[model samples]
Target: MGNEDAVRDSLLIRGGFATLLSFLLGSTMWSATHPDDGSAQLVFLSSLAFGLVAAYGLTRPTMMSLPKRATWMLILTVLWAVLAFQEPTAHYMIVALFALYLYRLPLWWGVAATAVVMLLGSGIGVVVMGSDVSVVVGPVMAGLVAIAVAVIVEEVFMVGEDRRELIDELIFTRSQLAESEREAGVVAERQRVAHEIHDTVAQGLSSIQMLLYAAERDIPDDSPARDRIEVARKVAAENLRDTRAIIAALQPRALQGGTLADALRRLATASHENVPGLSVEVTVGHRSDSGALALGTLEVSLPIMVKSVLLRIAQSAMANVRHHSGATTAQITVVADLSAGLVEMEVIDDGRGFDVPGALVGASGRAQGGHIGLMTMRQRAASIGGTVEFGSAPGRGTVVRTSAPLEGHRLESQHP
Candidate 1:
């Protein structure tokens, strides 16, 4: 819009200058050559005044409406036509009016008007001034050339406007897609919350209520009613504990919107806060690495599902290191390759390692009641097109590596 306005203003100034020049040269010529023709002088002077006013009206721009400009252009056209008939030298004024007509009138109308003005001006020269063939052909050919140039320029402007409109529509479509994805995420989270409550807190509460009811019915002091009460109290306490744990599990508050690096840093900090005698350093691969993203470059963010899984897997791996691994030093590494569409996370600990098969069995309840930390981490990785692997030996330290492909999951790395 701004570019079109600039073009319009420039053409207006050119037209005004042309009309002024025509009027000056024509009126002076009329005064000297046709001194006694007062009527021609009057016609030329009146046309000049109207043409000047109409040309400058271009300066007060109003792109959205055409009525005001159309009125001025129509008046200018009639006056210029009359002035040209009186004095053929004033025909230069028609060139200025042609610009206004081309800009304001419809296609067929503008062409017809240009032809009418050209024929009228040439007719005046031939009939009144006894102009020869050169006068007749020159202006006619110039008029045709001018109309062609105007049409080409207008077509270019129309193409530019169409391209800009397409760009805006594409932007709007992307915004709509982003909004729909957000809403889908919300719906998925709601479903998760419903399932967690029904399976954990709700079921636990129902069991506790039943146990207390049985204790109340058999409340005989001599018939083991005290044992029943104690059992009921224990069940109630366990239920309460389970409920709190379920709430905390449902709320992975540390994990939120951020880059993969930010999520790792926060997870490392939280582990340091919650565990004693453990100092974990979080680091990322250099830009030169195979699957490592460059720091402080175009942001490559992980999906919410991927972010959540990565954070949880890191937390679980760290907890295992703190409790089972005797050594205190641990390192968490994050690497991503946007071009290759790959992401990998590793938690390495300088602690005593154990038999991997035994750990898996113990976690699956095959061995005496064991921690599910490792098993849970594996499940979390698998939830989002990911993998979990451990490297360990009796004397060596443990390294838990998790990897996922950013492309196969059809996830896009958003740039901020």
Candidate 2:
């Protein structure tokens, strides 16, 4: 049962026990005072009646019509008070007063009932035991005390309930605010991706289109320049394919299946088809047991951002192979290991690698010429607490490996 139900049940049990005890005490007192009299018999029957009524009220279904229950309780309270005056015993009156409090009668009604019961009990005690002022005063004082205590307890309970409800409302509002912030972040990231594509891939494709059109106009139909023009056309076609793949990978509709493997495979397939004589191989580890990685472990933990970064890395790697590596084959491997809490990606190419030092120096010199792709890749990796390593020599092939911790271990452990 819920807390409220448990509390109500406790109240009902206590009320029932108090009622039975009062009935027994009152019956015993009447039996001793007037053993064979009609008045003693009447008191005995009234006590029994009060006990049965109190039990019925206490055991009644809580969810039943409140109005109906309240009406019946009020009727019983009146009968108990009237009968108590005739018997000169205050037990039924006490039970009736407790009923009013337990049922949560209105404040004005409670106050009025308390006053009436005190006056009635005091008058009865004064008339029946004329010599004892203590008898009248004590019962009156006890009735006032019971009413005051009941009111105080009810007010305190109500205040606590109000505070609890307020706390729950505040928690709900906070959750909604968090969700709104996340949606806003996603929108901002999408805009950033769009700007990047427009600045780089779109501009490059436009230039290639213009160059191919110019070459077509200048080269004769059967000349050596025509062959060169054909090669440029092929290069432009490859760049166009790369641009489309970049768009697809950036948007990443492939994440509908709930894994990055499908998107990466699509990227590798597109790369192989676009670059002649360059074979691309892809290997993806099992993701069935892999848990979701956190943003701290990978700057691109979000599916969209992850796809964008991977596409850029793949594009840069493929471009380097085609332009400088003289490679015939490339291997791409993606691994997601939840148990180890790591996601690893590696791109290896069997190409004629150049000196890493020379390339860095060259890249640094041309840094002003917008050689920002490699730098951005490094920055992206660092943002996610991951590391990017590039290995290459004058004769050895190039291998690029990136590893990021899954499950956001750092963030998870730090949360309070």
Number of the top candidate by TM-score?
2
Show where candidate 1 strays beyond 4 Å: 1-47, 59-68, 211-416
Q: Quick one: best lDDT, which candidate?
A: 1
lDDT of 1 by residue, 194-309 (tens): 45674577666767777777776778777677776777777776776676455434433554334556767776787777676778898875333344456543234455466567
Query: Which residue segments of model 2 deviate by more than 4 Å?
Result: 1-38, 61-64, 91-96, 221-416
Which 10 successive residues of model 1 have the least lDDT summed? 407-416
Cα TM-score per model = 0.46, 0.49
What total of clashing residue pairs does each candidate reach? 0, 0
For model 2, how does the per-residue alpha-carbon lDDT over 241-270 read when each residue is reduced to its tens digit?
A: 776566444453544343465666676787
After TM-score superposition, what is the CA distance of residue 182 in candidate 2 from its true location, in Å? 3.0
